[model samples]
Target: MTFTAMVAQPPPMPDDPGGRGEDFGKSSPVGLLVLLVFLVAVVFLARSMTKHLRRVPASFDPPAGKHEAPEKEVAPVEKPEEQKNGAS
Candidate 1:
């Protein structure tokens, strides 16, 4: 006996009452211009701050009577050659 298989089909899309024309009129051009102005002001302020920081000089010495020497680090003790040869 031979059997025939049925092909599957996608469901039809729903109709939109308010289409693409209804969405186009809702955009605000003035709000977009204000956002652009604010972005430009922020970029200008950031560039000014970077220039000010670059012009400043670094202090070489600490405040008087507060100067202290940094601590010296102790290295780990290495094994002698005589001990290595004896183990082998």
Candidate 2:
């Protein structure tokens, strides 16, 4: 009356017409068609991406060692002189 003895017994065979279940060992035509369609779509997408990428420039940065205007130095402001008490 243990669990092992109960599961150890084999299941009764089914009286199917073909004497076997559906065989999945071989590829079907529909599966091959789906794979072919996926490959074609990927090729088209890659070609489109390449065409768009070619229009972009290699770099958008400004040229090195070039200045539009010369730089100027700023002078420090002078302070007012302190007046003595009531002095002219």
Candidate 3:
């Protein structure tokens, strides 16, 4: 009787197949530029938003006693004599 051990092994990595492995898992220059552009845009947007937020009034309610000119004082108009008498 004889006993044998069978072991499974993972495939080996290629040193450089068709120059594909050299730059594998590496970021490209274009990718870095795009990321930088996005970061810049985010910074500008944040600055703009902060400025606008600061300009906003703390409370939407107008300041006390600062509303429209005191409502004009208008005399009530008199009704027509016929309408007052009563129309049919």
Candidate 4:
């Protein structure tokens, strides 16, 4: 058979029943409620994390006490003088 004869025409599309059936992509109430719950949880967690983070210190050192003495610096050791040419 010729290519043109072998090719069959597609069936006609159904008539457009515009605005007849329920909308295809409408968001249900349950889905909206779930989304709202998720958003609220995110906001609550963010606020809570911010509150906790504000109490954290940048450095790990403990705060100094009023009665605590300051640390002392160590002095370097002096090297003994070398004896010249086997002289004791």
Candidate 5:
């Protein structure tokens, strides 16, 4: 009458070939073909990624210290003499 007694009972075995349940939980050839296709795609993708990674340059920045940048020159501004005299 208790749950333990119910659970202790062994599960019934599936009926022999006379029943339609014989093929239950079984995979077909189409499933195997799909799995193989996905595996092949993954392999090809991995190879392509490897090839692209190899083509990539290690550093995007230009070579350091190869070319020195020219120094900028600043010009001083001079006010007109008329404006300077008017302000004074």
Candidate 6:
């Protein structure tokens, strides 16, 4: 047998109960409205959660006795003067 012989024809398309694609949008207005409402709620919820999360800090304190020593200021180093023409 060949591939052509094994292939079957597709079923016929069903008749439209309500005039072609004319009622397509009419039937799903509620679904679209619900989806929009859900999307807006999700965005607002995420924003609120993010705002609250930012208020919390990651680390509470440094490890036991691992406290960093106080920083000290150091005087700036001075550069030697450049020699003039042929000076040893």
Top model number, TM-score: 3
TM-score of each: 0.37, 0.45, 0.48, 0.42, 0.47, 0.40
Best of the two (3, 6) by TM-score: 3
TM-score of 5: 0.47
Give me the displacement of residue 87 in model 4, in angstroms. Answer: 68
Q: Against the unseen true structure, what C-alpha lDDT does each candidate score?
A: 0.82, 0.77, 0.86, 0.78, 0.84, 0.76
* lDDT digits (tens) for residues 2-50 of candidate 5: 5554456756776664555658779999999999999999999999999
RMSD of 2: 15.4
Candidate 4 lDDT score at position 41:
100
lDDT per residue as tens, model 1, 15-82: 76456444655769988999999999999999999999998878767778878877899997767986
For residues 1-88, write the lDDT of model 3, one tens digit per residue. Answer: 9999999996787775765675768999999999999999999999999999999888888779898767888998768996777774
Ranking by TM-score: 3, 5, 2, 4, 6, 1
Q: List the residue pairs that clash in candidate 1.
A: none
TM-score for model 6?
0.40
Error in Å for residue 36 of model 4: 0.6
Off by over 4 Å in 2: 1-22, 64-88
- State model 6's lDDT: 0.76
* Candidate 6, run of 10 with poorest lDDT: 77-86
The root-mean-square deviation over C-alpha atoms between each candidate and the true structure, in angstroms, is 20.4, 15.4, 10.8, 14.9, 13.4, 18.4
Report the error of model 4 at residue 48, Å: 0.5
- Cα error, residue 27 of model 2, in Å, equals 1.2
Please write out the lDDT profile of model 2 over residues 2-49, one tens digit for every residue.
Answer: 555445665765787363555636779999999999999999999999
TM-score of decoy 2: 0.45
**Candidates ranked, most accurate by lDDT first:** 3, 5, 1, 4, 2, 6
